[model samples]
Target chain A: MPVEDLYPSRNRTEPAILDRQDPIIHSTDFSAAPISEEQLRQYEEKGFLLLPEVFSRAEVSRFLNELNQMQQDQALLDSEVSITEPDSGALRSVFQIHHHNDLFSQVASDPRVADIARFILDDDLYIHQSRLNFKPGFNGREFYWHSDFETWHVEDGMPRMRALSASILLTDNSDFNGSLMVMPGSHRKYVSCAGETPDDYYRHSLQQQTVGTPDNHSLSYLHKQYGLESTAAPAGSVLLFDCNLMHGSNGNITPMPRSNLFFVYNAASNRCVAPFCNQPPRPEFLATRETFDILPQRSASQDRKAG
Target chain B: MPVEDLYPSRNRTEPAILDRQDPIIHSTDFSAAPISEEQLRQYEEKGFLLLPEVFSRAEVSRFLNELNQMQQDQALLDSEVSITEPDSGALRSVFQIHHHNDLFSQVASDPRVADIARFILDDDLYIHQSRLNFKPGFNGREFYWHSDFETWHVEDGMPRMRALSASILLTDNSDFNGSLMVMPGSHRKYVSCAGETPDDYYRHSLQQQTVGTPDNHSLSYLHKQYGLESTAAPAGSVLLFDCNLMHGSNGNITPMPRSNLFFVYNAASNRCVAPFCNQPPRPEFLATRETFDILPQRSASQDRKAG
Candidate 1:
């Protein structure tokens, strides 16, 4: 039998809330740098964990150089994988960077990154999606509040909440520089949003998502239950969050720009099926259903040791 | 356990030929128009069946208009989904037409087209890929000799031969106008080609495939065993062939252009997994690893009654 869509979101008349149907972690392997008991508790309660200075200054500089080169290349910028800000026409995001660039692929497979993901997901994993997000100063746009799994389950067929995102900051994120904000404990509840997803929705949704976002009532409910917490960290920090975490970022109006390399890892057992909303699945760059190979964790000492 | 790569082709040491591993016809459903015993025997023996003028002239004209409109739109042509002929710089192929156009989607699910696929595959179906192939009058290039399943299995993770291509001719295909040529009875043998599938191979392979073309030895062997037959049919004809058939077409040096609407339908049970070559799967436009919703058979009388 086809897996039931425990939490259906889009293409419906009304919004609903249900309990999350999957586990947060699927494995007990702690061979790598696993989180401590206290850290685990904090993540379980808050739905996110922020680690500071995970990379060295030199490494961050190299990432910035590669990102700058990609943005400056007119051909690369014009490709369909790159999306520019709607208002300012500045580079906003580049999808599938792990497949597009060698450095990013290495970063995706890096032990420091993948080990934590494996420990959290507790199973073999594949890259569900990867992107380099750029929030240019002045006219940078705000990402609306929504749960990643709401979109994934509706359009990409992700089966469960067994995925997490690792966002590596390439630029300093200040309070005024559009830092990411999350509603604490919201990941425990699944929010079903209203509206139907139009055909080829990703073409516009990637630039500005209107359909899968949370409604005002749901947002108010989440805000009232668990007040939002914003992360203001320096470059080289990494923020790991659950797939169903209700999160968004403000528009950057300060001089400091915000940029991050983001990678989403999904448990191999939780590979996608047909979309829950019965719509056509999004493109592979958004949610990969191709590969289910267990990611072989790289030896930690082979790359830069965490500070 | 992961399905073994039974017919591994690209990204290997040497070419090998194996017996066909899967069935030709999957279902015995005959509710819709079914192939007669003689026609079935002919398809089983020669691996292809060409229906003469399955569509009316008006329907063909509407398809031509849609194709022309899509080609004339500079923005659509500029999109990454459109590929230009390497030499002539004219539009050669437009992919994902079933999603890009409303008319084509209806055509895809139409009983006249999909019912035959359902009967042959003997299972619920999903479109693995769809495209509009345009061979401009003078400068159209030749597609190399190769089995469609070899590429689909190697790069798209298609596990079996229970798939077929439905080529709906938009223009009359004459002897000189770059009609598809197939090696009779070659579908029984799986030809494993020689070469590694480079990263992002589809970018170049779509326009001019060099890596996955069958070697001279295999092609010569197939040619000697089963002579090639060129499909020279009129407009509105539909050509159905097994996925593993050794097929290619010559360059159109004539003044008349040849275009066809091509759709590949795979059994629902045969959805893709990881690529056999261990490389990243091609983007969705080439090989869909997305939604596998069964194509609901449309009522025959709803569309034009078969001509």
Candidate 2:
């Protein structure tokens, strides 16, 4: 069977309103959030869900300390990572960070994120891939309109939309700074979108970002079907989006910076079978096949005792 | 004061035989390695030490799956990372992987490595940076000889030689494969080496690795003073070396692969203060400043209990 065997074709009419639970909107502490039926409905209905203020200011401060520290640590500064603007030379994204840092590792497998993924996937999970997307004030570039699944299926060999990406906001994403914009309910349309050669620097393709974002035909079709929705939330918000949902972000021309740490969770059975395109997938740090059990959530009291 | 104010000159007379505890070398199971005082002497005398067969075939198989999966995982392969040969489009190296995957994350912070760093620097530690150096058979290229500190101190504001790097072998680093070649005890020289711009594709420079490796003066000086040492071991062997050690690798012409996972550990107190060179430091993924508390070691029994 073809990888897209289950999905309705791009020519199919009337994209379905896949039903899911309501999003678990939380405040400052997600580990404590109960997984409710409402959240499942939100995931199914909108193809994305928002968990607002999942981390406290103190936690965000701690995250920033580590984020800035990597730039200041001499050993790391000398490493070769993805720096978007060579001229201004600010960070665009950093791949495979969980491999080295404890903070990233812990968060990537955080119970809250994992539980959400488990409910959506209905199977054991593995990290399909991960990255830190940065929009440093004035330097953050635009992420062209595109669906992640187009690339995930063609490049990474993901079979279906059984995976989802969760973004943990590291910095406040105001309107002025670039924010994620999604086409409402676009996940129902499975577009056999296009692909392009790798970029000279990061080798990335958005199917909508950079080189081969949606063409006039696809763009007009998407526009005709769905209106755009923007996610301009504060730091510590956890935004989860479906794999096939069409999304993009604008340029940050303002003085503020917006950064988010994203962890992509995949259903174990939906592991990459084979690359749909000719070329192989990216490096392991960016995408991993191993499925590790998420550590049991430590209650506030337990954490205090351990500390 | 210049960054060099704190450091002894290249002309410093005595190269202290800094001594410490023996290596807590382990086999496939990490909890198995017994830390002996003898390994410390080896590290002091040679400036690099080997932990042979630290992982088992089963563990290696798990690693290979994750490694290959990354290539098949389209999102990662599509990511903008530095590839060696844009012509063949093979992954040359991947930066900041510690940010992403679980296996890489756990191993990078495995107690064995942290204990080594704590012993060597005599202080709490932070991950300076991490990367996967891939020398996949024919496409693997040469890493010209250079001291890592040359770049760290001059470009990233590192004040001293208090860092060490550990390379966990992912593939069998046979004699034919491009294995690391080090000049023993070379860390003693605090050379003010040169620097270069990042490659158009890779976005990196070693002070020498990408730009100016070693001029004739330094190369000949090292050759005359010390002999080249090759770290050609099995897939599970780990080769730990000083950050200031003069080292490089040859290209892989033979059919063997010599890939390794490298983690650079820095003393928490030695966080980067300021950029010493003309340009600002590289992206945060390459260098981090946060000092994370190491989680207590998970014994084999504890792991089973948790499981």
The TM-score measured for candidate 1 stands at: 0.49
Interface RMSD of the candidates, in order = 26.5, 20.1
lDDT of 2 by residue, B90-110 (tens): 776666677677888777767
Q: For model 2 chain B, where is the 10-residue window of minimal lDDT?
A: B18-27
Which sections of candidate 1 miss by over 4 Å? A1-307, B28-33, B302-307
Docking class of 2: incorrect
- Local distance difference test values of all predictions, in order: 0.82, 0.62
lDDT of 2 by residue, A279-307 (tens): 56654554564533333433343212101
lDDT of 1 by residue, B1-307 (tens): 8898778786577887779977776655433436666666677788898988888899999999999899899988999889998866899999988878899987888787787787788888899999999997544566667799988998899998989999999999864455887888999999887889888888888887878887766776787788667688999999999999988775543346899999999988889999898688888888877755678877667554432
lDDT of 1 at A288: 85
Q: Model 2, stretches more than 4 Å misplaced?
A: A1-307, B1-34, B81-84, B194-212, B290-307
Model 1 Cα shift for residue A277 (angstroms): 71
Candidate 2 yields a Cα-based lDDT of 0.62
